[model samples]
Target chain A: AQSVSQHNHHVILSEAASLELGCNYSYGGTVNLFWYVQYPGQHLQLLLKYFSGDPLVKGIKGFEAEFIKSKFSFNLRKPSVQWSDTAEYFCAVTPSAGKSTFGDGTTLTVKP
Target chain B: GAGVSQSPSNKVTEKGKDVELRCDPISGHTALYWYRQRLGQGLEFLIYFQGNSAPDKSGLPSDRFSAERTGESVSTLTIQRTQQEDSAVYLCASSAEQGTKNIQYFGAGTRLSVL
Candidate 1:
């Protein structure tokens, strides 16, 4: 079974601050990675995904993630965050033939 | 007409009663999935249906939890003799294909409260 690990449970930052959320997964085969975000009362939305392109994948709202196979990590990053960026973020991975596995999630609070 | 849809946005049931949750996938989609989101917990895979073939029920937590899909349109997840622990947000998502790379469109979810 594949497992996902998120290094931080909650993160607080002021506006315009750089952000990085660590994510690691345990899977040896070909895998697809994704980051999803959920606002306080909204449905989960895809932030970004890595299928077969470059290691660094960019997503909506100025979010990006880098896939490092050797480290088994796909960490999410943003150069500067806004107050509206406060939300809960989840990292998920899916093997070629299995269902997607998600990390516990990291809550980001960007204060103005 | 746009995304996956789930019925009964909220449900409250007695511990010993049975409850059924419904999901309507987007038109033309061939793959549908069911997931559970407990409070403060990540989404847990429950089941997956690919077209008219037998569904992948490997992620179902226990025998008490079962799901069914009709054709390629609607799916129903049934909880037999629901318990308090069964309370959670049941989410439904659908994709165009069976591969892991396909993007999944999710519904707002059905919040089930088993008391």
Candidate 2:
């Protein structure tokens, strides 16, 4: 069984502040990583995904995540966040195209 | 339709009653998934269907929870004798095929409240 962990439960930041949310997973084999965001009442939407190749994967809405195999981590980051970026973010992991296991999620609150 | 669709966007049921949740995947999609999102909890995998093959029910919490998918189209998740603990947002998602790289588009979800 694969497990994902998100260190930050809630994050509060001012507009234009840099952001980083830590995510770690326990899976030795090949895995696909994803970051999904749920704004207020909207459905969960993909932020970015990593299948292979470059460790740094850029996603929608100026968000990016870096996959570090050795560290077993794929952390989401954004240079500057806006008020619109306030939402709940989730990190999901799938081993070899199987079902995904998601982290508890991190709630981001960007104050304007 | 354009994306995965879940019926009864909000369901209020009594404890000990059975409730069925429906999911209609996007046209032509071969893979569909059901997940539960409890308040402040992560998305919990429930069941997954890939074409006409047997569904992967490994993620189902207990025997009381079961799901069925008709071919590659609609799916129904049934909770027998629902309990208060079963209350949560049941989400449905679908992808192009069975692969990790494929993107899964999610529906707004069916919020089930057992009171």
Top DockQ hit: 2
Candidate lDDT (C-alpha), each: 0.94, 0.94
Backbone clashes in model 1, listed as residue pairs: none
| Candidate 1 local Cα displacement, residue B26, angstroms | 1.1
Poorest 10 consecutive residues by lDDT, candidate 2 chain B: B95-104
A9-63 per-residue lDDT for model 1 (tens digits): 9999999999999999999999999999998888888899999879999999999
Error of 1 at A24 (Å): 0.2
Judge candidate 1 against the unseen true structure and give its global Cα lDDT, from 0 to 1.
0.94
Backbone clashes in model 2: 0
Against the hidden reference, what TM-scores do the models get? Answer: 0.97, 0.98
lDDT of 2 at B26: 93
Q: Against the correct fold, how does model 2 do in TM-score?
A: 0.98
- lDDT string for model 2 (B35-103, tens) is 999999999999988887888999899999999988888999999999999999999999996767768
Restricted to chain B, the TM-score per model reads 0.97, 0.97
| DockQ for each model | 0.81, 0.82
Q: Candidate 2: where is the Cα deviation over 4 Å?
A: none
